[model samples]
Target: MSNIVKAKIIEKIQGFYEAVDDNNNKFTVKLRGTLKKTNDKLNCVIGDIVQIDVEDNVIIGIEKRNNLLLRPLISNVDYVAFVCSIKDPDFDIINLYKNLLWVDRENINTILILNKIDLVDDKELEDILKLLSQKLKHIKVIAISIKKNIGIDKLKEYIENKNIVLSGVSGVGKSILVNKLLDIEELEVGEISKKTKKGKNTTINTRYLEKNKIKIYDTPGYSAVAIPDYTDKKEIMTWFPEFKNYLSLCKFRDCLHIKEPSCIIKFKVSEGEIDKDRYEFYKTLVENKGI
Candidate 1:
């Protein structure tokens, strides 16, 4: 007879998943593919809780997930930190906005981390923070310097005892931050290319670190984010958190908030209430709705 055991996936390698049971026993399991065969939306991913039908040590079934991330392909992540460097790779606001939209659409709780504060001067750092503050109102922004060991404690408060995922572009110091938080230097930190001035991808695979009752997932970094195509073009506007207050005030019931008559969002942009750069970015998104 087969017995069922509950386990949470910690790492996924090729066709195998590394999971730990409630009793802290590690198991290498294979998927039953039952959910996929039925065309169900559920699929196995790292950070997922699953039940396995095993006579010895093989997985035959998977449980449902509380949540999932498309880009990094992680499941049931409680918190996601979008880590970006201030100087080395430079903060790409456009890419950052796209990431924010992706998180918002997924309805995931996230925070933004502007890393490498030690590389910039006081004035420059202040300006960058001010710009981000205006664009990202109501969202927490933690400015941290991994090398200088600044703001690590405050950052830890958010991720403590939570299933957290660290995602950002290459060389943004995601691995370095993890090392600091975990208090170990096992994870390799990549160096920026001298010729291209871009960060080399250090982490090629998704890995998890469990320590001090903290579960952290470190994902490989990407140069560019390819947002999945939307079935409905109007869904784009809903991703912008800043537009929420002005949404009900729009004249049309299904307003795109661009070139529409009596558009409150546009009015706010013109009146300097909304950042012009952000509005332009939103316009760009509206123009390229499929992307």
Candidate 2:
């Protein structure tokens, strides 16, 4: 007799997937031939719920995903915590904005985690927080020092009972954060390169881990994140939550907000209602197609 069971794909190693069923039984399963052929719309990725034949150790079917991230290629994520460093690798505001836009396009919740707060002075941290507050008023921002144990408990509270993906540039202490959160040193922590002053890549692949009722996907750190292209350029503005109010007030119904006469978004930028840097970034994306 063959046993069919529901499971969640936790990780993919080699050609087999590590799936866990409701009873927390682990199985290394391969995709069924027919299921792989019909995987056009359904991708077998981490966080995917599937049906498996335990006896055959094959993934028989995949359920529809609630949401999918193309760049990281993950599915059904409740939140994306973008981790950044204040000192060693330095904070890249442009990259952070790019990440925010990417997740916003997917309609997923986001939280900005500024790690290594201990390295920066009070004034510098305040300034960065102020700037973030002005531009990302809709998003939640958390300043934490894993070394000093500051804001760790608060971070845990926010992500309690949720599935989150920790994403950011390399060397921002993502692996360290995971170890701290899970109270385990299973993940290796890499040191910053002396020559480039950047973090070395410690996590080469994405993995799913669960502890204390929290599920997290630790992804490989990235130095630079590229925003995916969209078919409709007009849709770009919708991702910026700050542009919501003035969008309707624009002169034309289909205003791209660039080189357009009587554009309220432009007028707001001039009036300081919108951050000039952010507006400029949007214009660059719209004109250059995210090149």
Candidate 3:
């Protein structure tokens, strides 16, 4: 008799995943391909609760998810932190905006972390902070230097009660942050290549630390990607918290908050009410999404 087995995906390897059954008994396994065909939308990502056949050995079907991320392709994730570094890789504000948009479109709770604060001078820090505050108004931002062990307590506090995923580009200290979160010795920190100045991928799988009631899913960093078409942001403008109050005030009801007559958003951007960097971010998004 095939049992309807429900399991929470913990870690995924090349073609196998380590899942926990209802009783917290763990098993290593793979999904049946029929599941992929049936759930047209299912891809069996990390953090997903799936119903397996458990007949012989296979994940037969993945139930619908409460939350999912496309770029890293993680599912049922409760929180996403867009970790940024103030120096070294230098802050790529544009990519940061795109990451924020990904979370916002998915309706997932998100936060921002400005890592490597110890590397920047006060002026640089203020400039970065001011830009983020003015532009990404709806999101929360925390500053830290994980290598120096600064602000990590606050980062841990923010993610205390959730199944969280840390995602961003390489060499921005995602894995370093993971080490801090897990407090593991000889903590698998990979060095960035001196020649390329890029991160040596340390974590190849989604690993977790189960204490403190916090399960942190450290995902492989992803290259910067434009927002996925896999979602419907019909009112894309409104998806941005900072854009909401001024959305209605846009000249065209269909206003993308871009290039319109009597556009309040443009006015704010010009008046310095909106951060110019964020305005440019919207422009880039509209261009990339071809909205």
Candidate 2 TM-score, true structure as reference? 0.86
Q: What ordering of candidates by lDDT runs from best to worst? A: 2, 1, 3
lDDT for each candidate structure? 0.78, 0.83, 0.74
Number of clashes in model 2?
Answer: 0
Backbone-clash count (model 3): 0
* lDDT by residue for model 2 (1-291), tens: 548888889888766899987677898999888777453534588889999987888888899999987767788889998998888888888888888887887888888899999998999999999998888777789999998999999999999889899887767877678888887854433232442244343666888888887678988866767776779999889888888878899879999999989999999899988989999899889888453
- Judge candidate 3 against the unseen true structure and give its global Cα lDDT, from 0 to 1: 0.74
Best by lDDT: 2
Between candidates 1 and 3, name the one with more favorable lDDT.
1
List, residue by residue over 1-291, the lDDT tens digit for candidate 1.
438788888877777779988677888887775445554333677888888765656666666767777777788888788899998988998887777776776677888888999999999999998988888774678999988889989888877888888888877877667777887754433333342244343666788887776678887766777765688878877777778788889889888888789889999988988888888887888788543
- Clashing residue pairs in candidate 2 are none
The residue-level lDDT of candidate 2 at 77 comes to 87
Clashing pairs for predicted structure model 1, backbone only: none
